[model samples]
Target: MTMDWCPGIREACAHWQNATMLQHTFDALQMALESDSDASIDAVKGLVECICRVIIDQLDDPTSPLKPKDEASITEWVSAAIRVLGRGDVRDRKFADLIKHHNGLAESLRVLRNDAGPFSHGKDGFIQALTIYHRRAAILAADALVTFLYKAYLDSQLDPISSREPWERFAEGNALIDAHVGLVVDDDDSTTLRFILPSGDELPINIEVSRLLYQLDREAYVEALNAARGAQKPAQVREQGEH
Candidate 1:
């Protein structure tokens, strides 16, 4: 079935190994279309959270200390995915502000789900009835937010450099050394190439020194060595020796 609110959502998510979440979202959307109840609104909220979780799982670094907790809110999940997908673009102040706006929208959706969705909590008094218009608005908002984030995720996948962390990008650029050594950047901003010895001990080398020693081109290697030794030219070195 075609999802009119978010065109191409099915195709975009077709490659995912687990389709249960997407199926549930589709069912929820269908329910919303046929009913004018808060139950449908609750389902729309679930759809948004599902999409956010999927994006975060696919894009976030598994080993990062800052990974979101399992109990994170929908807004927190959205923010995590945004941080990954918006990496290269977040440097722009305007783009960063726009991301903040998107986070606000996610928070608003969460608020709507909590306040108006009957399935979320028991109410003491009579609540306002939601019309088909309310269902449509919820679907529209959820669809737009999910679609935007999914597009950004897909775009990041297409660009390898932008998708990788800083150290990974450096490793990818230096093909020869990348395979032989692991790149690491310390908290103090110092970069090192770590080589594992036969005894399994790590031998750390400064990045610049490693580059000079293992440069692929012979001429470039010589030039780097000469530059390190504070020599302008081979002739100048010989002349200085006479003095």
Candidate 2:
């Protein structure tokens, strides 16, 4: 079955291994995420390449500005893509910080040029962590670009970023949700398992595994959390009254 909505795109994973997968297309990449590994890097690279094509499709004229032969122009276009997402006005507040982050993300993409090193093979802890950082940046960057460029296409469908957060935490929170919920297959039911998204959409979920997603749906978890907090308030009041 074709998955309608996959929360795996913005998954929040503390460790790298939990966020990597060999996805079919960047369009399809939202369905699965783990971390950046040597094995998974090629897939993500392809995914980003697909997103680049989408960017072209999104543009009004879709020519010049980003020349394949020019790294400088490519970086400029990437900078512009990072801006005006309702994140910042570029001339207004957050300008300085935005440039800093924009530069950082662009610099991180530089590592994609090379596939050999401790970062690529995972020998050094620090470099490996840096590579993971860069890869995730690429993922989020591509995802955000898609969100901005293809707003009409994305809005009509159930896509990545199911839940929303504050603007400042948007990127981090979006990435975090990817790992929060996952599909858990039922061994007894080899034929099917009912997995419904909060939006009431359903899908096959896997190749052989008929599954009920194991993790808590975001809405349910939030409701349960609020209830637990509310439950505590009454207990605290009762103790205060007794005192």
Using TM-score, give the best candidate's number: 1
| Candidate topping lDDT | 1
Q: What is the number of backbone collisions in each predicted candidate, taken in the order shown?
A: 0, 17
What clash pairs does model 1 have?
Answer: none
TM-score of each: 0.56, 0.33
In model 2, the Cα lDDT at residue 211 comes to: 22
* Model 2 lowest lDDT segment of ten: 10-19
Q: Per-residue lDDT tens digits of candidate 2, residues 98-126? A: 55665555445435524323433455434
lDDT of 1 by residue, 112-189 (tens): 777777666766214478666666666667777777787786566533443322334344445765455554555664
Model 1 misses residue 119 by how many Å?
1.7
> Model 2, residue 204: displacement in angstroms?
45
163: Cα error in model 2, Å: 28
* Model 1, position 218: C-alpha lDDT score: 75
lDDT of 2 at 42: 35
**Candidate 1, 103: how far from true, in Å?**
0.8
**Runs in model 1 with CA error above 4 Å?**
8-17, 87-89, 122-126, 158-243
